[model samples]
Target: MGSYGTSMAARCCVTDTRPTSNPWVVLATLLAIYIVNYADRYLITGLIGPIKAQFAIGDAMVGMLMGPAFVLLYVILGVPFARLADRTSRVQVIAAGCVLWSGATIATGMASGPISLTLARVAVGVGEAAFVAPAYSLLSDYFRPERRGLAFAILGLAAYVGQIAGQAGGPAIAAQHDWRMAFYSMGAIGLLLGFAALLLIREPRRSGSGEGTVEALPLGQLARCLVRSPAYLFMMFAFGFGVLSGVAFGYWGPELFTRAYGMDPVAVKSAFAMNFGLSGLVGMLLFGALSDRLARRSMIWPCRLSALALGAATCAILMASWAGSFGTARLAAIPAGLLGGGWSVGFMATLQYMLPPRIRAASTALFLAVTTLLGFFVGPWATGALSEMMGHDAAALRLALTLIIPFGFLSALLGWAAAGRVERDRAALHDALSIRPAAPLLARPAAEKG
Candidate 1:
């Protein structure tokens, strides 16, 4: 089975051999975009109660805003833009995306009602669709496989900070200055960083050397490329369920506190920031590092032990939701967040493991497609829709959020099965290390390259 080799190095987005002057600028630019990315993506949660009250919408509509509306275009746009990133300067694509989405966030602030908010959200999804596949690919080229986890974890740090700021701070900021100011500020930061990313991060030459040869997959051709691997299919479902459950927790967390514990807005904000935000921050870093270490030891970490552990943890977390005391669930939140963060470890590992170097971006895009279609689109909306059908009561919310437990367990089972096949299945994957061909006397099939 394949595992990234050992190396210890770090740098901003600046390329090593390239004439490009400052990679840190790229790092800063991407980090800034991530901050804006998360802020725009999540600001709705912060504003949800007020927005719902203003528009007379229910939790279902609120769920849709965070899910299907944003996720649909996000899934669609991801691959095509990733194709462009493989062919062109990733920096340019990211800059353009930043501009599109940042502007969209501002328009969201201008939204007077639900339909406009939904439409503006679609635009935000479209814009963001162009960013991630390319950004992940770009960052991979600059950082060695060993260090990429840390870089990505740092990138996730920006997201966690944004989550805390967007969710925890937004309500408070909106209370003082209006949600419009928060949206405008987030958008403005993106616009400024868009230019900066263009300046600082030079695109590295496409990777196809030590680890592997580049087998370029063209745009519109990614679907066929996905059919070869059983592991990929399992990973898809695994990643989908993991992300879906995470979004459920993010969307309903504050409301859960309100309905169950009768906490006021201020207390909710504190929990959102300290419990979810702070805990999530620690979770991301810890899980990222842990996955890398495990992946190094176990070639099949992507579909291996991580999933087994995650499934068990998820079951316990679901029960925590029904805890008699808010303080108990509050204490439980720290470990729950830590385990929840493990999803990214598996998710990113799947991307890195399932494809060879050349097709990484396209594979990532396709992966995002599943993640979007299932995780973002269905998860939150399902919770809210179920909640409405059960009536506007606490019991309904409890039922809806709790459904994720079974799905998470199901995902873990699939991953464990995939891991069982690692010895029989992953022998072909061992050469995923160095790119050069073995002797013609022992040639393996090309289709098994990843």
Candidate 2:
């Protein structure tokens, strides 16, 4: 197993000696695209009330729209798209994805019924699935291993930015125009960004000393290698639990604020935008920088920091769920957003350390598959069903939110456990594969060898 791991590393990992241009430009462009990416996807959540009234539907149907309508195809197509990213130009894959999803979002505006809207959302899923894995893979190449936490965290900040744009802007547009116009507007923004990505972004050289000497490893072997690692399994499960709680709240929290606190749609949208934007941004920057610093001491610190942050996030979320007033809920959301920001930076940064370069994109796709399928699909759907079962009232929604809190704790615990094993896994990869930490972009020689 060790020998195979070493050989795989030697075959797959590229050591790019060619000096690159400012990688931060690449990071900024990708970050902008993700902001648009998330804004288009999450815009629907803020408009749930208007959509429900328009279609004469209930919370369960809205949950389906948020969850399964997109996630099913999103998870299914992730691997194949990720494979394409691995084999071809990642920038092109991302540009194509942006166009496809933007087009789908525009079509959603024309959705006259639930069926048309659902199909449009499914198309959005297919487009988005193409973006994430490849994007992560691209970022990994632009930044060094040590700096990835911050780079990825900067990318992760898009979630909050996108949500802010969607939640704040979507409802405001809907208030004046209608839900359909909001969709059309956001979709148009994405289309513009997609074209910019195609024109401005340049693909970086893949790293590894022996890149042309060996063929890429088969996907079967990569899957087998990952499955056999205790560290990978633990990290994925931890990510799964965290994503489940996070998605459920993100998708449903707006409705809860409206129903339970009697806030207007505009008020809910603004509050959510501010809450996610300010708090999540603080958390991402703080924890991402912290993780990078602590990682200098030990690989385990990132996971440990994540474990602690997850616990903080869980407590904050619980406080928000039970808070009687809108102001109190917003206050609670601060910690939730801030701490929640750390999980991606910490765990994913840790995962980057463990994985060989060749398989990074696929590993990310697999991570997304598990998290999206269970977290995005089952989490919101189950919450909606639970609320309906409990009577479809604000109180029932509160209860449903309460039930998912345990998953947060479970996730924190998994991170704690995973922290202990991360070093061992890193050691195994190093001892067997002779892999060392990657040099930061521009640190190597400027000349490329033919």
Predicted candidate 2 versus true structure: per-residue lDDT over 100-197, tens digit per residue: 99999999999999999899999999899989989988877777666778888899899888888888888989989998999999889888888888
Q: Which stretches of candidate 2 lie over 4 Å from their true place?
A: 1-21, 212-214, 427-450
lDDT of 1 by residue, 1-450 (tens): 222342222333223444553444555668778878987877888777778887899988988998888888898888888877766777898999999999998898898988998999999999999888888887776665545565677677776777777787778778888877778878888888888777677767765444323445544344543544556667777777776776777777667767788777656755765686677678778877776676667647645755865676576567667777778777777777776655565556545654566667877888778867877899888988888888866778888888854577776776766664453333333343233422221124345453
Q: CA lDDT, every prediction?
A: 0.71, 0.81
lDDT of 2: 0.81
TM-score per prediction, in order, is: 0.87, 0.90
Q: Report the backbone clash tally of model 1.
A: 4
lDDT of 1 at 95: 91
RMSD, model 2, all Cα superposed? 8.0
Q: How accurate is candidate 1 locally (lDDT)?
A: 0.71
